[model samples]
Target: MNAHNIDIALVGAGMGSESCLTKEVKNLIDNADIVFGAARLSNSFGDSDRQNVIDTYRVNDMIEKLEEADKDIKAVFIYSGDSGFYSGAEAAYLRVKEWAEEKKKENADLNVNIEIKAGISSVSYLASRIGISWQDAKLYSLHGREYKGRVPEVIESARYNEKTFVLLSGASDVIRLTDEILNIKNVILYLGYHLSYDDEEVMTITSDKKEEFLKGEIKEGLYTAFIQNVSPETKYLSYGIPTEEYIREENVPITKEEVREIVLSKLRLFRGCTFYDIGGGTGGVTVDVAKISPDIKVISIEKRPERTELIRKNIDKFGLRNVTPLTGNATETLALFDENNLVKNDNEYENYVREIIKNNPPDRVFIGGTEGQFRDIIRELKKFGRKIRVCMTAVTLETRNEILKLADEDTVDDLSVVEVNISKLVRLGKQHMMKAENGILVATFQL
Candidate 1:
């Protein structure tokens, strides 16, 4: 707006100039002597006249052209989406800042003006179109070529809550990311690409069905997918089992109701919390936790090769998006904790938490069986101080004695137990009676 100066405006034309452009933005753009924007956006101008125009992927090029323009000239640099919302304006601002800094050092008499304008983002657009309440959905961008850690937390969190995820990026990584989380079941996916563009496309698929689409079952390339949880009604069985069907069970692998309730109670499992259930049995505890709190992530870890398959099946049957089935023993499976707790000084307990959860520690630790080495597992967990709640179930008096011995002492804080007796109702000619199944619950909380 200044006279005798190069005034730069970073603008977002929104999706298709017709839908996103506000009258205020249109006015500023109309008055500019020079305009710069993406090729697609630049073409959207139709027959509009302009003194000069530039097209390029990078905003720095646009800023350079602005710097070379005549003094007192108005120039508008445009980008897609809202300039403030994952648009090119952010990079433009950085380049402009650097250019301004360099100019100030050379000439105190010269001044440059820059302003960033707001626009709608694809996140909001896709959310609105899908009828998702934007207020409930968390937002993130995996399109940043420079970002790495962005998608994991976002994906995990979404799986935790079954939130509507609106991703704006290449379809190449969609399957790869899904493969990484195949253990999580009942996820619905929707991918939207080039929104508001002539070639724009959107598609919907379940995570399990992603394979069908990935195998070129769908011919579309530039497309986005919308996912929802629509697992078929589970096949009735005496108990929950893996969907794979071929998985062989060993060593009393089914989870007793008593054990599951105590595990859920102690872990304090809830939506949005991530955890690993070591030695998950029939995925009962993990599935229960996930179902009870859809936002909490419950991953089942089992070392028995046969049991691993069962865990996966159970995940699918229950439509548990929050549960992930992992196959491995305590030592190798939980190495993250081992590496975290290993320090120079054992007495440095505070450093223990700083090393573990700060780095990586399952929010809730469930020691259903302890893989035949209870002492070592308990010791490894104790090293982490607190911030991890550990629960265990013991069937034998000796194992119970060991658990009690550990709980009796403050090796881990807030240790408690629940001994439950559950009985099944057998219909005797329209009558039912209770049969008791006994189990002990041992829980210890820290931090």
Candidate 2:
């Protein structure tokens, strides 16, 4: 088990060229007995011998090679961009450190030293090239990962922050993101292609010209994007969105603004919690809750297909990607979501529901309309055996009585009720008058 002293250095190669390498990194590469990195990074250093330079970016493969190599050697692992910013350097460092720790435990005399060198990140390079500060920008990377939810997340980040920087994989990611960006207004996309290389190209396009830009050809390679939103929506800081702001059908029922504020307050939402808006009519409550945090997954279930379509439209209008609309009876949907009945079926929506529920069960549940199956829905939720906060709004006396009856149930706890009465100012012939809307009773409790 005895091993010789080992010096492991995880170095950042900066942008894609030799000129971007820090002087210290260059010295490490020059003096190291062996080097490990992608072919592009390892070959960039002309002085390093090809025999000593191992062309492999996989962390495990690098570790395996290091283990098989001779002891008492100075080994360097090169990573593209800054080692700390969404680069593989972090993983390589951790894995090597773990290996060194285990080896040292077996052999006390073995000297293992691991160090990480910070290189200029693409964000910093692009920002400097464009004459902008990156400290105020939000950074994200879609490289070597699933990007299904990331497009909306980056778009939402741009809407809230003045600048957003995203490290993309290739032309596919760029096209997908730009297609969504075209729907937004007042935001500009700055794309950096093959940054720091001889053929590096930087293109700036505003939201208006995104269509034409997408129509033309985009060379595929390493890419990074910077989004500048002139007007960030600061109003999302508060929960209550005016009902008039939503695109609503005259026949569909929408939750009142005042009532939604009370319901959201009672729900006490947190980041990354799964929320279910059962009986979502116009999706007013779903939209408000989803805005609270992009991490929150809001599932709006409506029985009527028309109402579900309206919810989708509202989600699009607000540029929100976290809300998923399910069209079916609320009680039936609850049954499908039950722990025992959840099976991956051919239905895409059902499978999606199962995945979300299985991974992140409902932390918060809001029932605006129960369709007279209120008790059945509560019973199904209780089967999950997790602490869930439930909020319900009742406009009719029967529905109010049904909610009140839940207080006596063994599954319910911390029950509280509040009646919200809203009145609007109206103009009569020569004077203003107060008009009263329907009274809503809001009930909140724990399950």
Candidate 3:
């Protein structure tokens, strides 16, 4: 159990600098019989010949080489950045634990003696470089090799956290990520490229006219990152917030608060659900879904830019991060993720969203402003699965008939209908009177 007699040592290589390494970690590397890490990383120790330092870019290859060594050999694994972050230390530890557990059964005297040393992470380094505290930041990595498919989830994380710290892989990804983020107004970007090295540079840009500034600074194959500064929104976990909390304007409509509560309930959203708000005018229902959980991906689709602006304004006012406004017709925007149409294209945002659709798909879809394309939109959503949740609200008798026409025994499961009518208090001189609001019929299906 003694660290000094450790048979396996994992050391953190802070920003690939020998001077930044801890004295204890340096001593471990100097006294160890073998060292393992990526070629570029392990080469930092090339000046020292007292130990046999093995280098490989792949983690599996590193483990295989480590296992091939003598059973009693003292080895050290070096990972760049803080080993506590997404530095692949957990995976390596699990693999080593499995090896040690299996080895103990075969050999009577074999015990895995492992020790970990902390190092500076990119998040900490960037925070120091930008003079900002990362104590309130959410940590994420786009540099994962195995979990590469989940890279698009970075946008999802940025939606809820006031500060999001992302580890970049290359310029392509950084551009794609920042472009997707710029879709939402009020987000300020702080980028740190080649952090802690001689060519290191830190840049900041507010939302106003940032595309050209970003273009001039981006270069391929650089160690890059971006910190999103957002206003933190308090989640109203107690039922729902009052109607006046959201921004409202003329020509842009929103669902009534009472109907919105029942609509979200019918959606049956669980953890990590992708909720689509078609005809998402003013984002009233969007906020209702997002306030419940930060992990949900809520997309508000509207045709008019003015109404889209209302949604954005509402997003900023409520400090909601998970809700995004897409300014396109629902029929067209939803088609972009269609399985047949979404091959590969220049639109990185579309491609990124398509990947999420392929992996998670929409768990719940709300049709509030279908704009007479309700049948087409539902058909596209049906492509995801037959057993998905679809909730639609009709405010008029004519629109209610259209919703009923889309329902059938073959397409609907556990189908049900509910009507919500609300009356508000109004002041008339010295007395209060009840003013009736328009009623909405909520149609939901297990399909």
Candidate 4:
């Protein structure tokens, strides 16, 4: 053991099999003084002494072991799959690099070297085995993490992209996702089980066999999947989804496409923000905001049950996963969203409601139909005690005046208003005439 130097290698073991190991990674493992990985990865190399291999993939545990070493050491941390592709190798490398730098600063004579080796990712391996090019596929991972709207995001991705590749946790996840995929038309599901092992299996489920396949049992193991959308929808780069594209009823009012565009712009949405679409009539505004990003959590609150159902239909038509439609009065719903209200109920339904309210607080808000509860809703929003950007539309003078009155309140800032009037050309017996719609007042403020 030398006293002055330490060398570390962060290696990607590749697809849980010896055959998938890269030559460089194999060589590093062969000569490593100490190895760190999960038991499966460590067991793959039979020749390596068990005493020198730590059966743990956590970076902190590996670092602690290294710190206890009395002499200079060559340490290797093995991660499954490509180091760069959603593997623990990246985090291990970063943490080790930071640790080494700090150690060098404390001891002038110490020398530390760190290197990262990449390996075959499951995406590429599965794609190769099935004779498909993965360059066109959109990749997502659900391994060992909780992702909000996981199914919906995947479904939406499959709709827009020709192929959607997902790295899943286990058998249950595969079944759950497959069940959702079965609802989509003209899509093929390619399921890979225990990839790269001797018993590796891949099954292709088409629309024809989906019903039969869903009823059968699924083998439990690490899984990777691909959904091929035969007729992928065209991707739209900007927001304002046309009004005709939505499922609208004559009675339930929808924010017009023109007004939606202006209101969304005024709200100043950003990624991962929580948005409250209070009085989400037909969910037009809710869907538009949700389309901005899957990370953006849009909760659509509607007072009428029929309108809430209509909002849900529009959500389904658009294949949006990030919008949560709740049926209740806007102000009353806001009151129920409090954590105190959550503690009062212990039922499964209340638990589900608790998760949503506890996790997402409004970062931005859109008040579409207040039903004469405008001031009450504003008061509820103010209770959050955080800066919130608000945008609302008013077709009545009373609502417009209510918005203006906020300027006098100390809690509100940057209050501004704009009136939008739009006209469309309609065909009247071979002649086109401009038809005017009611003007809407768009108000924006910060709270």
TM-score of 4: 0.93
lDDT of 3 by residue, 1-447 (tens): 111222887778777767767788888777778778887677776434676777764556655765555445777789988888877677787777787777666655655687788888878888887787888877777774423344444544565557888777778777766666665545677777777777777878666656786667677654546557466334355544577888889767888777887887788889788888888788888887877776787887788889988889887775566676777777777676666787878988667656655655677888897767877887777766546788999987777887676555466677788788889899999999999988888999865
Q: Candidate 4: lDDT over CA atoms? A: 0.84
- Is 1 or 3 the stronger prediction by TM-score? 3
* Model 2: per-residue Cα lDDT over 58-142, one tens digit each: 8888778767754688888899899899988877778888888887777798888999998889999999989999887889999
RMSD to true structure for each model, in Å: 8.3, 2.2, 6.2, 2.3
Q: Candidate 1 on 132-236: residue-level lDDT in tens?
A: 756665555555442234544544455555554535456555655555444456666666767777666666666566577678743323333344444423323
Candidate 1 structure lDDT: 0.63
- Error of model 1, residue 273, in angstroms: 3.7
**Predicted candidate 4 versus true structure: per-residue lDDT over 1-447, tens digit per residue:** 335678899888888988999999999988888888899887676246443877898889988988876677888888899999999887888899999898877777778899999999999999998999999789999888664456657877887788999999987787778777767777999988889999999999987887787688877789999889988878777778898888888888889998989998899899879999988888889998888777788899888889889999988877777888877777767776664676656566446655666678899999988878987888888877789999999999899888878778775789998889999999999899999999999999998
lDDT value, residue 309 of candidate 1: 77
Candidate 2 off by > 4 Å: 1-3, 46-51, 343-360
- Give candidate 3 regions above 4 Å deviation: 1-6, 46-48, 103-111, 122-136, 142-166, 169-253, 281-283, 286-294, 299-360, 369-383, 398-416, 427-432
Q: Please provide TM-scores, in order, for all candidate models, with all chains considered together.
A: 0.62, 0.93, 0.70, 0.93
Residue 270's lDDT within candidate 4 is 90
Counted clashes in each candidate structure: 24, 0, 2, 0
- Where does candidate 2 clash, by residue pair? none
Q: Clashing pairs in model 4?
A: none
